[model samples]
Target: MLYHGPMAVYNELIGQGSLKEDDFQRTIIETLQDLHDRLMKYNPEPIVRDGKVAPEKERGFFSKLSKVFNKKEEERLAKEAEVARRAAIPKGLYLYGSVGTGKTMLMDLFYSSLERTDKKRVHFHNFMLQLHGRLHKLKTTTHQHEDPIPFLADSLAMESRILCLDEFQVTDIADAMLLRRLLEELVVVRGVVLVTTSNRHPTELYKNGIQRESFLPGIGVLEENCIVKCLDGGIDYRREKKTFFHSAKPKDRSKLASSSTMPTIVQDSSTILPDTLVDEKRFFWPLGPDTKKEIEMYFKSIRNGFQVTERRMNFLGRELVLPHTAGPIAMCSFDELCAKSLSAADYLTLAESFKVLILTGIPKLKPTTLHRNETRRLITLIDALYESQVKLICSADGPISEIFGGGSGAHSIDEDPSTMGQLTPAQRQMMDDLGLNDVSQVKKSPIFSGEEEKFAVQRAESRLIEMQGPGWGM
Candidate 1:
């Protein structure tokens, strides 16, 4: 195979494990290429600069250039020479762009192709989290002189010569402060080439924060030590959605829908009969401008007989399991589930208890975002799910991660708006003006019993009689 670019040669070597680094770099590059191919297929518009799908203007130029470069012997010598030159180079490459522009894809490709003999790729968020965990371990340890960061560095340095980080955003105050020193020790002092992708331009990184100026020199060092490329297609790749979701079977859809039986109101309480089951094939239903109370009522009714799955599969091929079960019932609205704001623990508990969590109505959460608190909770949630091996089924406007941008406690959330941050006065005001903020401002007086009303009337009459004529109630 005649591999063309520097990346191609690197990939070829790396794939064979003949490269000096380990598989981390090779994996990263392959992941990037995978992401690019996935995006081009799933997204309605272009994100990657498809060399095959070049503009009309460039085709003629390429045709003429191809004729000039048709010497097989010369090309072979040139490719070898170019590979040698790149291998000897000590510097790295920098990719920066807006979110979803495939900077990550490019970087991943680059990282994957490199010899796994000495490469590493990590998400900035994950890297910091690991570092923090190490720090925590060191702090609790009995050894007083042991440095956590140095311990981490020792591990990192053990088998990697090239490091690649995705979403190189520095927003955490503590991370920002320590980042300069960490990179210095890892890349500068250790001579490991560093590669990264960022949403913000390097000059604008760590912008307008406490002592941000201090990080500028480090940014300068990065600028000086790398080949920076800004692939600005001036297109919002994220806005395009070729498909709402993956091709799902009916079983998959049913797995996400509410399984509860519709409960009937008896006197003051809602009760679901044991025999009731809801047969809702469609997993999601959109709600109009609905109130929280309405959502609550809906939740109450559905949970009554809540045995959609259990009832449906009452018997196996030859065995009878719930032989007394009758028929399927109506589904309860999921409006309440999405409306009720939950604590991290509660959400986690709920996730553990239920096989399905149907979130109906316009999902208030954008998959692309999580608040700082949400990010932390979500990361914990993801970790918990991974450990528990639980699958998440979300029916939303888009993909779960994309809808809420991969938020961060490590990277500045500002770089990714889907990240958790306090809303500004202006933003809050906008929401308030639109009536989106005060969702519960409107209310109706509680409906009272006829007997209760009569009791109040009788009490008022008795009090009036006592005040007017103390002698008798004729």
Candidate 2:
């Protein structure tokens, strides 16, 4: 019996009783197992290790001549195998489900089981950013007139024949339009396979938006090229822990002053206290048991002016240098933290690095202003902080509900020119790379503007409210 790939791993995990069994997950695993078997049969080089050709025996001249002919025959056989493998294109899988349905987990298992080297797994957003960058380069440099989609697809195929994309979504209209052509070229032309996970079904993607009709072709291509599997499960395993972090009710100012320790000044006047001291009152808010008045009094107790040493740390393959970090607390501007291409992994790193984080200047995430990337990053950051039990103190433009409002109106980029002006250089570069010529045309229709994102923002908003509760950080 030849058991390989995800099924084997699944079986092993089952035997160990490490994972609970799910019918949907098992179906996906079985499908992946079948694909793995076919890939092994067609692309035998990955499954079988070939030994070095044996040294020619020092015999007669005929023996030496035979070795040369044998070498040529072997080369021909290898070429034939390569051609056969290329002909056997694998049908990719697209797993879709609600949040925490084990789509990412299953995809990861399948990805790990693959033996091929020409495979890659990436977040869909990051992948799009890269694709746009490549497209921009192509447009500027070598191929101005030629269709760039096919070229980009061909380039991607060359780099990664099997692309395992997570959290696949088509939010931006530009991305939606490009995705159709890119998918068609990759699947129909280049024979590159795609295994992706999304919260919505193919038909439901890009649901309602300006010029959404143009995006339907991409949906058709996805349906034709990939096997769409829905992972059915109800429980959000991540939410099992109700109290992941401490919380406390607001207390009297006098009580707060007595209970909280005064900041101790080090011998060096420039050196701030190691734990949870904020230099700027405007940048920090004392949530939970500590009131603003209490915090101010504590600061006044420390006679010497204080400064914190900046430090740098690496997380998720990105270098983050903090301007202020002492003991278990760090502070930075919201844009400085989130304006760049930071992922959940970077947020996780921040959570691990600090007990409390003081973020300043969080703008309202209104539909009108529609700082999509920045808003998304904030949501991810909050999720990370909440899960990791990190306390958050921050200044925002408005209350949670007002900032992350729920409405059905379309979010136009042109609604707030001032907000657009505030976009970091990196954000501007991304827009430029994506060839976003007209903001008016890129309106996010109420229907197709991503319910998942809205839900995520709502969750983040709820978390923010919870963090401010008297019980928070207790």
Residue runs of model 2 more than 4 Å from their true location after superposition? 42-87, 242-308, 311-322, 325-374, 380-444, 447-452, 458-474
lDDT of 2 at 116: 81
Among all windows of 10 consecutive residues in model 1, the one with the lowest summed lDDT is 442-451
Clashes of 1: 33
Per-residue lDDT for 107 in model 1?
61
lDDT by residue for model 1 (1-474), tens: 754333564455445443333344344444444433332233111222211244556458777687577778678888897666444436566677554344554564454444355667766656776677666666688335654555555556655666777667665456767676666655554455677876667776666544566777668767765667675554432233220111111212211111111122211133323222222122222334334345444445545544444322211122212212112222222232323333334434444443323333333232222332332333344333322223232233333333233322122334545533444343356356644443222111001111112222222222221212111100
lDDT of 1 at 115: 37
Tell me how far candidate 1 lies from the true structure as C-alpha RMSD in angstroms: 24.1
Superposed on all Cα atoms, model 2 deviates from the true structure by an RMSD in Å of 12.3
- How far residue 134's Cα lies from its native spot in candidate 1, in Å, is 1.4
Query: For candidate 2, what is the TM-score?
Result: 0.57
lDDT of 2 at 43: 37
Q: Which candidate gets the maximum TM-score versus the true structure? A: 2
Measured over all alpha carbons after superposition, the RMSD of each candidate to the real structure, in angstroms, is 24.1, 12.3
lDDT of 2 at 274: 33
Model 2 C-alpha lDDT per residue in residues 98-121, reported as the tens digit of each score: 655557667777777778888888
